[model samples]
Target: MEQAIVIRSEIRKCMQEEGFTLGGFSKATEIRGSYLSLLLNHDPHKYPLPMRHFDSMIQALGKPEGWLYECYVDECFITGKTDRRRVEPFLLRCAELGKTECIERVLSRLMENLNQLSLVFEIAEKVHAAGNQQGAVPFYECVAEHEKHQHSETLAISQYRLFRAALGQDLHKNRFAATRFAPFRKRLPVEYQLDGLLQLANTYYTLSDWRRLGECADELIALAKVVYQEQHQRKTSKREKTPLNTERHLVLYYGKGYLSKATAYEKQGLYAESKKCIEGYADLSWFEGLDEVGKKEVQMFQIFAVANSYTLEILMGHSYVLSEYTNYLSMHKHEILSGLATILESANKYGFSVDETLEMLSKEILEFKQREDLPGLGWRLRFHYYLSIYFLGKGKIAECIENTLQSLDLSVIINNSGAFAQAVALFELCRGQATDAHLNNYKGLLEEVRKRERFNLGFHNY
Candidate 1:
């Protein structure tokens, strides 16, 4: 006789009328099958679903959103079925021991009761920390889907976790996971907001969206300053235990802000500003606690800035910068291929014998070009341009022109001004040896380059 029972019976009737079996409904709504059975067959007075569930079920059944809510008994209150303190330790132990199936079982049971979803979040976090990101992803998705309409903070945390796990997958290389944070941005705490913004800037770099990258860099830098000042005013601990970094969020945000800004400046060909930003990035006062991978990434960025500085110096007729190029390359053996090319080019310019380096580089370039999936259009363009330079250094004029033509073709395809500039410059240098066909194709490619320059998009492709 309970109104809750009546409401549940009506929901079942509506579902049956629409020919939606519990399993079909579960599949359509992405709800767990056992959980759907609990909603349809359990004692509604004891195991009532959340209001959000009613809305989702109704929407899936092509009913009005509030039909189930209107029939619900006012006295039915959802309460926790299991004590979280007792359940969490067992789940955490299972996760720590790598019992993924056991963890999944516990999560499924916990998620069946509406009030036990917090425990689901806790168990998912444990699984994530146990380095089973793929396993944790589904748990986070469940929590987010169930809690999205009513619990903002839980939804934000769950979605962020899901996004991070997806980002870690190699299949997601060309995808920008940070854009998934938009819907949850306002619900995230200040520290997470900063983290999200940092990732957004990284995503912009991946997509080569320079204008947006600059905007995000400026926004993040401003937010970092404000958050740092507030934390300083509160006299918060200088270090916080966090999953992201050992230091406080302040230092991590500050470093990321400058790194992103420097990248934007470098892409815009403002080398001096980029150098200043990179220096600012390196000077952030938390290196003592930075993890090894983080340290290496920062070192790589510094090497990028230094290599750019060296290139600018050479272009401006200051060969003195080459004095330190070899030392820099030696210290950073894992420098980017572009950086390696600068060092080798500098060596050639200085009349140093780079024969061994050029031979090794030629082999490496050939291998890269043979890969089925080129890393990116810009990287491939740079590789071809660098190969041309290497071939020219080896006195192979025909081979050099062949590579230059490849670079020019890709530059035109991608509208990459910087690569086009390099290709055109190389073409001019090689024009003396060109046959009639080469001359005609050169004119067409040169005109395309001129049109691109006239457009003045100013984006650096390399």
Candidate 2:
């Protein structure tokens, strides 16, 4: 009698996990509960119910098949009157089961398919809301990426709406603030080209690939100038001028050209030309009118100019300090002291010391030490460092070690990051050790140097 009666029950596991019963799933998926109950429980292989009903039930459970299978009474799973099935059910099932590996794999593949993106962004927003900014950035990036075959007029129109919605999301994303594609920049033809150029230039800068930086900067400046001139002409005929903010940025762009020019010259060992280009870097009156944000930005740029000036001088094999060579040393105590320190270091490291170079360096160092007047000049002023190093070259290890320790101490007191960092950077680079043991000792010394006065705002002390 049990076999004779046709027993029926809907397979409700996937539906229940979606927070639904058969009827609830029906309402969500727009399928009648009775029909869903029939479809889930039925052996479709035998009775062969409607394919749309099967798809609706799957969709109600938040499933997405690759393509809907168009199956009639008798059709193959692959080639029947149907689409290729996506089988998103396995992923949802894995997620419900809390199988982490399965969830990661499923999500990875799902993100790759651009069609499954809206849900991806929704999931990312949830993750971000749950305080996983690092995790959310990649998902946001994936959502913003264009589908290879799907970008057309309809998609272009929808992109702005989606991007705005993504930006408006209430979630924690600060850690991902610098991530690529999280905010989704405009992809207008003009914007798209700008993006490409920006990327090209950034790659060169990050890698310190000067040749490429020069090439890209040359191209970008040409393009930007032409476009800017056209816009300038158009605005001249307009009733009102371009906004003040826009005007400031246009000026800043010119400054960037100068910066790029300076960098090129510096790399080419044309130190004077580089210094000339960057000398008036912060004297822009445009900075005086800047709002808080703009002022902060200009300040950072000035800091960079100072840092670049120091680097160029170091690379040029010249002691602008102690060697009547630098106009900058004529202006400030800081430049004079720092330049003398660097030149002393160079004389000791490289055998480029003229008799006067060593004599003048020691006198300057001793004079600065006796005065003990500079706030951050403690380690820098201690020890007639060049003579000490010259003695080291003549195998005076005890005196060399003593002078080294004094310089290291001064590095700590003044918070002179460049001096501290370069000491370590150079020790690693220099291979002229008396023995393997001594080499290891110097390496250990580098490791023990404590960095104080921490600030990531970058340094202004050139």
| Candidate 2: C-alpha lDDT | 0.47
Model 1 Cα shift for residue 293 (angstroms): 12
TM-score of each model, in listed order: 0.51, 0.40
Clashes of 1: 0
| Shift in Å, residue 278, candidate 2 | 2.5
lDDT (CA) for every model shown? 0.64, 0.47
| Predicted candidate 2 versus true structure: per-residue lDDT over 144-263, tens digit per residue | 464443443223323432333333111112112213322232343333333334444543343334665566556555655655665567676866564432323433454565566576
Off by over 4 Å in 2: 1-21, 24-195, 239-253, 279-295, 317-462
Model 1 weakest 10-residue run by lDDT: 168-177
lDDT of each residue in 1-462, candidate 1, tens digit only: 366677778878887898998789988777798988887798765565654566577778887534544343231233434545435654554445455555556566666776777768777888887787776776787787678464478789777777666553121232435566656765777767777777667667755677778888887888877866665555556665344332233556666777778767766768788778877775443544455665665655555556656655653446566546545654554443555455445555555554555454554545444433223545566666766887788788887888788888767665556667778899889989877777788788778766755323454535
The per-residue C-alpha lDDT of model 2 at residue 212 equals 58
